[model samples]
Every structure is written in C-alpha cells, then in structure tokens.
Target: MKTLPALGDDARVRLSRQGGFAAIHALSRPREIEFAQCDISQRTRICSVLEGCLTLDSTVSGRGDQRFYQIEVNYRSGGQEDRMVLKVPEDQAPGELVHLWDTGQLL
Candidate 1:
C-alpha cells in the first residue's frame, strides 16, 4: 500500500486562532497550501490535512503495468505526519490535488 511522507523544512508553516478553534496552514511552491482546523478545547492538536502532496518528481519508479508514480507530502497536521506515497490517477492533474489539499478546497 502507498504511504504518505513527512513535512520538510521548506514548508511555510503557520497557525491562527479562529473563534474557539485553531487553524494551521503549511504552504509551498506555485501557491499550494495544506490546512487544518481544530477545536481549542482539546488538549492536543485535532485538525489535520491528513494527506497531501508537497512536491512532484518526474522520475518513473517502475516499469510497465507494475509501475507507479510518487508524490511527497506532509501527511498529518500538528507537525506529526509526513512521507511519500504512490500517486492516484485522479480526474484532475496531480498538481490540482496538491492545490486542493493545501487550500482545504478538495471536494
């Protein structure tokens, strides 16, 4: 199974207080953004991006039908999760997924 990657030092990570909640944004490249919203009443960070692309590489990982692509990502919010995962063939381009994931605009 494909797994997600960790957040890199390149991420412009930030946090903001929204009403009774806390929202975090981690942005990078060509205007992509990863966001999370959490309730402030909790003792820990609850909001999370879960999984989203941080970078894209053109190199192919395998050959023919057994092949798959990679997208590096900051998998979880609160600076806890990050990794690389296989790219999923979506209706939109891979960059679009990254944009949606970053901006919290995914449908």
Candidate 2:
C-alpha cells in the first residue's frame, strides 16, 4: 500500500484501473474513521477523514482475485508544507493527493 499526505483545501481523488476510486480529506486534529462498502459493478469508492492534522493511511484492493494497493498521508504542523507517499502496481500510473492547513481563525 502507498501512503501520501493531503495538502491544502483541495480534495484528492485517486482512480484505479479496475474502475475504483478513493477520496481523502485531512483535518487539523485526530478524528474517528468511517468506512462504507458498496455493491457497484466493478467499481468502488471509499472516503476517509482525519480530524487532527496527522498521518492518513488507506488501502485499496480488488475484490475476488485482486491485488492490494496501499496509500498513506502524513500531516505535519510547524512546517509550511505537507508530505505524501504513493505505493501502487508498476503497471499503473501514480495517484494524486492534496494537503491543506487550517488558518486557526474562523470566519
């Protein structure tokens, strides 16, 4: 599984060759993890949120005779930048992840 960090307010979207996709969002604090499975034909979409700016990890695998691909997102405070890592099949292209930080002041 590959891991990456979500930077900024932009949402990160990943697509799989088997018609699967995953979206992730990063928060300033640690939060509860939520997951839901679907019965779509050959396609699945999963989402996860991190409450406290921290590492975000995710795993994607094909159901019924499939390999597993992993992803991780690392969020760091004090630094002005975010970090991300990607691990996927050699036959597949790289995925994109976004990172964003809170301004601390609310509107």
Candidate 3:
C-alpha cells in the first residue's frame, strides 16, 4: 500500500521537465520511489508530507505486542541542512510527536 499527503490551502502543484538530455543521451532523473510490492496484501501503508522542499516520510510497523510509528524528515534551508528521525509507539497519539518535532526535541 501507499500513503499520500494531505492537501489544504497551503498546497500548490508544479510540473518540471525531467525527460531526455540537453545534447547527448542522458537518463531522466527519477521523481518517485518504486516499492517492491504492488499487491495490498504484501504492502505496508505510509503517509508523505511535503513542506517546501522538506519531506516527511512516515510509517508504522511492528510485531507481537510491540508497534511503532516512525517519521523521517530531512531538508536544507539558508545554506544549512538538518535531518530528524522519530518513533512513536502505536499506543500514543501522533499530535505529541509532532509537537516534539516542532520544538526540536528528541526522544
């Protein structure tokens, strides 16, 4: 399975030309990642969020009594680059996790 980002008033869409080469033959850059599994039964669902050039990749996985939701985000701005990885238990709400990330706190 695949997940999608929420689109609201802050969302805008743009298109970029990435096919072919300017002069000689060149390969087009890939814009999306392809998952190895196509069938829903063999796939795990996740959500993606794009804020400016920043991307938030989130997913949930576990076994037995342990389960967790993980989020990975990385971006560059103002000549500085940053990355964050967060994992929240399945029993917990994602709001608090977002708050922690917003505050630059890690757990």
Candidate that would win on TM-score = 3
Give the TM-scores of the predictions, in the order they appear: 0.25, 0.20, 0.28
**Model 2 lDDT-worst window of ten:** 97-106
lDDT of 3 by residue, 1-107 (tens): 22333322222222111212242222211122123322332122212222311222234433444444344433343445444444444455355333333442213
User: Which of the two, 1 or 3, has more TM-score?
Assistant: 3
- Mind giving the per-residue lDDT tens digits that candidate 2 earns over 1-107? 33224332332323222313433223112221112122232112223322221133223434444322333333453565444533343224222212211221111
C-alpha lDDT values of all predictions: 0.33, 0.29, 0.32
Misplaced by over 4 Å in model 1 are 3-31, 36-70, 75-82, 90-104
Model 2 local distance difference test score: 0.29
Worst 10 residues of 1 by lDDT: 15-24
Clash count list over all predictions: 8, 26, 0
Best by lDDT: 1
